[model samples]
Target: MRPAHLALAVLVAAVWGVNFTVIEIGLDRFPPLLFSALRFLAAAVPAVFLVGRPKVAWRWILAVGLVLGVAKFGLLFVGMDAGMPAGLSSLVLQIQAVFTALFAAAALGERPSRLGVTGMAVALAGIAVAAVDEGTTGPLTAFALVVAAAACWGASNVLTRRAAPPDALNFMVWVSTVPVLPLLLLSLWTEGPARDLEALRALDRQGAGTILYVAWITTVFGFGAWGLLLRRHPASTVAPFSLLVPVFGMTSAALFLGEPVTPLRWCAAVLLVGGVAVTSLAPRRGAPARRVDPDPAAADRAEVTPSR
Candidate 1:
């Protein structure tokens, strides 16, 4: 990667890593689904005007949107609202990588390499350890909800690969539009009309400002910059940088939310980070030496799509 691109990658990671804090702040003001709806609405409007529609089948587009946007964020918001800590949520969500690998093998006929399998095992064990830790156990159901969100993220990964939109930016823009309606409906049903209206009406300047930051900086700028990077680099080169998100998330949570981090959580973090590195960096047993092929078609179509 060029120095400039590398810097951009790091910037994206920092932005995303701190997003957990943003989400927590937003939730303090707006209900989860409503906050999500507003975020996507912000992303969709400008992107639609600037980038236009991507050349993708509608079904695939909607599917991607529902899985990535609605399922992933909705469940995450609910999980967090239900008492799951932001730092741990950040760590557990990395399970999507393992889910992506498994789904890719099942759906795309891609075989998992020995390193990939071993890394997944180590990561899962780490997750199990984390799951058993007191921090995670406090709100077991919420933690379970977050796990489900990770699974939704994994499903979204497969759909993204299957869709294979022509332009990554346009694809992101169009698919981003899909979540608005579903999230609105979810907000209505889950949060109730009265509470939703009340939340909206009662929003102070600070709360509204938080929403704007999440919508513009976190959702729009973050996704747009990430989409650009993915187009320029291989997924392997770009994706592993996401492991840093949890690191930043934990740090930010500690600093801002005053969330406690225990030794067991640290051990789990080591396993999770190590597993992600092994999964990302280790070569496949029978795979070709070249990581990035000139022909995009020859590149390994693993299930784990970039999460820009």
Candidate 2:
């Protein structure tokens, strides 16, 4: 990558990192499901007109939308609202790499390298350590919810790899269109109309700002930029930067949210990020040397590494 591209990559990673803190703030004003619904709605509207026709079939779009947008994000927001700290939630979600690897093996018959297996072990160890810390400092159920969200993310990663959309931005914007009604309905059914109405009545500039930030900035800008980087560079070269997310997430949380980075938390961050780095970069044994763009669907899902 050129120096400018490197800088751009770092910027995107930072945007995604800070996104956790933004979500935490958004949760203060909106119920998780409602917040998530509005985010997709805002992201899809004007951008959909701009991004062009969807490149993949509607089945792929709908599947990814349901799993990634609805299941992964829904659980994530609810987990955070339920008391999973933003920084730690960011870190733990890295476990999706392990889940992704395992899912690929089962669903796609892609065997992982020995190094990949080792990396998964290391990542799982990190999850265990983080579990210990969260169990001590926070609600275990919240932590579990985030882990479940990560599993959904992993499943979605595999689904995306299968979809292999050529244009990440277009694929993602179309995917965005699929989730709004389902999430809104889920919010109404579960979060309650009165609570949703109360949140809307209380909405202020900050509340609307939160929606725009997550929608336009994080989803639209962030995904487009990351996809551009992948198009310009090798996936291996670009993938490691994702490891930076938890770094920025924790630091930003400490600075902005006053969330403490406890000793155990620090240890978990190191182990999880390191493990994901290795899992992502390690080549799979018996994986065919296909022409690249083999899995920009993974790219479309907001991660550079198709392996995850």
Candidate 3:
């Protein structure tokens, strides 16, 4: 990657890293379901008009939205709200790589290389360490929710691969539409209509800013720049940068949110991030260079490796 693209990659990673803390901040004001719903809402809207529709089937678009937007994010926000630390949430979410790999193997019969297996083993070990730590310090239910979120992310990745939309950003924008109504109804069901109205009425500057940051900065600019990078370079070249997310996430959490980075957690971060890098960059003898779709969300969702 060129210096400019490298810089852009780092910038996107930082935006996504800081996103966890931002989500936490947003949840302080908006209920988790409402907060998540508002995120997709902010992402859709008039911009949808400007971006227009993707050249994909409606079924695939809506399916991707339900899995990616609704299931993955809903579980993540709820887990974080239930006391999962922002830094830890980001780290645990990396397990999506492992889940994606496993799902691909089972669903697509793409068996892993030896190196891939080893890398997944290392990452699983790291998760076990983190889970043990969480058991002692955080709510196990929250931990479980985050794990479910990772699984949903993995499933979304597979669905996106199957859909194989022509225009990534446009598909992402249209797909953003699917979650709005479902999430709104869920917000009303879980958080209640009264609480949702109260939160909206009481929305403040920080909360509003948080919502915009997630919609524009994280989802739009972050994924937008990333998609461009993948288009400009090989998936192998660009996908490795995802390893940096947890680094920024943990460091920023410590610096801004004052979340402590314990020795064990640090060890787990090393293992998890390193394992993902290995799995992502593992040599594939005689394998073709993975074709990077125009979709940024597809790239990020399938961070383990680019599709063959």
TM-score of every candidate relative to the true structure: 0.90, 0.95, 0.92
lDDT of 3 by residue, 1-308 (tens): 78999999888888888888898889889999999999999988766898875777898888878988889999999999999999999999998888887887777666778999899999999998998888889899999999999899888777776776555567677888899999999999999999999999998899899999999788767766776776677667777888788888888888889999898898899899888777666753433345776655454334322210
After superposition, which runs of candidate 1 have C-alpha atoms over 4 Å from their true positions? 134-137, 281-308
Spell out the clash pairs found in candidate 2: none
As a TM-score, model 2 comes out at 0.95
| Candidates ranked, most accurate by TM-score first | 2, 3, 1
User: Per-model C-alpha lDDT, please?
Assistant: 0.79, 0.87, 0.81
The alpha-carbon lDDT assigned to residue 44 of candidate 3 equals: 83
Highest lDDT among the candidates is held by which one? 2
Per-residue CA lDDT of model 1 for 197-218, tens digit only, reads 9888988987777777766676
List runs of model 3 lying over 4 Å from the truth. 283-308
The CA lDDT at 65 in model 2 is: 94
Of 1 and 3, the candidate ranking higher by TM-score: 3
True-vs-predicted CA distance for residue 258, candidate 2, Å: 0.6
